[model samples]
Target: MRKHCCTPGQTTRTPSGTKRPSVTGSFPADPILPEMVSLAGGEFLMGSAEPHAYPLDGEGPVRTESVPPYAVAATTVTVAQFDLFVTATGYLTDAERFGDSLVFEAALPHDARAHPRVAETPWWAIVGGADWRHPAGPDAEVDAVRDLADHPVVHVSRTDAEAFCRWSGTALPSEAQWEFASRGGLSQQPYPWGYERDPGGEARMNIWRGEFPGAVSTPTGKTFTAPARSYPPNGFGLFNTTGNVWEWTTGVFDQRRRDHRAVIRGGSHLCHESYCRRYRTSARSGTTPDSSSGHIGFRVITAK
Candidate 1:
């Protein structure tokens, strides 16, 4: 096995060449995912410094990785871009079509109380109106959500993300590629910048500031999604890669690793030390490709 993260049906080509991106369209549709820039892959370090060392369930064995060169998205996908894909492709996201999707209930407004969230984190709720277009639930308006043009799109299943990428002549990043790019030249830091963490003590990414499932209110009004570029980029010129939303990748998890779900990278801003500690450098998680939830979104990549 060559540390496979790829599945069949999608095309793959090395990103080492010098082919520029073709003109896609105008302002209304800014090349699908404007937050990302394709990176030329080579090789990099993978895995944690110790086995089962991470507080989360997925991290493990410190191992050296030598992934072949490839390109990856610079940031997670955004709503505006996904909306354009829906318009053009007539694609229905899993959440929208499923009639309901999982949400971190406590993350909702307190006045908008509904039911106790799910058990895993006590924040997930099966909200009927939560979808990519309406991230806050049905009757929610995207127009009122200002400056989120660059924020990562939410409630999109892996299928939804893949469809958009395919329509745009792109594809999801592989597990190896995603990690390599996310490292952004930093060798062994939790964040792309280095182990020191957000300079001046600012929240490095958009993860929950106060608490996990039980709490949502934060000093920055951090209950919900923030702008895509709300934080600065990592050492590799990538932004919002760590904490905004979990990003989908093209790799399969179980075969290469022992995880049960499909692989996703760049822990979301929803990450918390007490709850989901996946914000670290070596963390990894999984879900069915067709399963769509509010916490998941994705970016894109193309061959050079």
Candidate 2:
């Protein structure tokens, strides 16, 4: 298993090599928007004090954090929603420009499994033709995205998310805002639903129930990304805030660096207790702005 399974970041060729398509001036007169959950944000304790928390990723030293009231989407941006943005803007994602992106070893087609894998993290394969539209690879399916329309759009970079925000008149949530909203009305609970991972023997969120890098599936036999609304909503009426897919945030992981990594909240279907146990409200990891993967996505936010 990868040493830092939850904080996987792949170094790719520079995105500046190819010219990006210019986005058109205006958004659609009537755009499809996600259901927004309004949060009257206040001071909330952020970070984990649990022994399982990762220290290098900065998941500890819980502190009092606050954010002004804001509205966030009830679900992560779905493939159907992202399709509308690409159709309107003609914008190419960083993955498309780079000609390849990372795919989970298990997610790749058996034939395509021979693709070059990432160093140190052998579970991640650098597959050509793998992007938001074709997460697994070109040969996996002809109309892969259309079939998974309701699933959270994966293989999107922070730049791609910001572009969508620009076109949709929305913004990515800050770390503070995301944490505040993710907590719902509860105080410092590991999960948005409550303390126990599964209460009453019912799975509250979609996460890996089996072994890491070897086996992965939800309780309902979901192998990959589940629908954005597959799970219950938190106290703030936000769905899948702690699992399904890691959502991008606007804040830099290390503000001191000129080229800083962006923070990603929530864990995905790949998260497991033995390895990547980041399926909680306060858990976070960082990756480059241009990094895109099959498990990474983003949601939009609006300030009140």
User: Best-fitting candidate, measured by TM-score?
Assistant: 2
Q: What is the C-alpha RMSD of each candidate to the true structure, in Å?
A: 8.6, 2.2
lDDT of 2 by residue, 57-115 (tens): 77778999878988899999999888888887788998999888888887776677689
- Report how far off residue 70 is in candidate 2 (Å): 1.0
* Candidate 2 TM-score over all chains jointly: 0.93
Q: lDDT of all the models against the reference?
A: 0.62, 0.82
Per-residue error at 75 for model 2, in Å?
0.5
Q: Write the per-residue lDDT of candidate 1 for residues 204-295, one digit (tens) a residue.
A: 77766664444565333533666666777777777877766788887666675554467777676567665555666667776666666666
In model 2, how large is the Cα lDDT of residue 15?
Answer: 57
Residue ranges of candidate 1 with Cα displaced over 4 Å:
1-38, 50-52, 55-58, 109-112, 115-117, 139-147, 218-223, 256-260
> What is the alpha-carbon lDDT for the whole of candidate 2?
0.82
Q: 114 in model 1: Cα distance from truth in Å?
A: 3.1
| Candidate 2 residue pairs in backbone clash | none
Cα error of candidate 1 at position 17, Å: 43
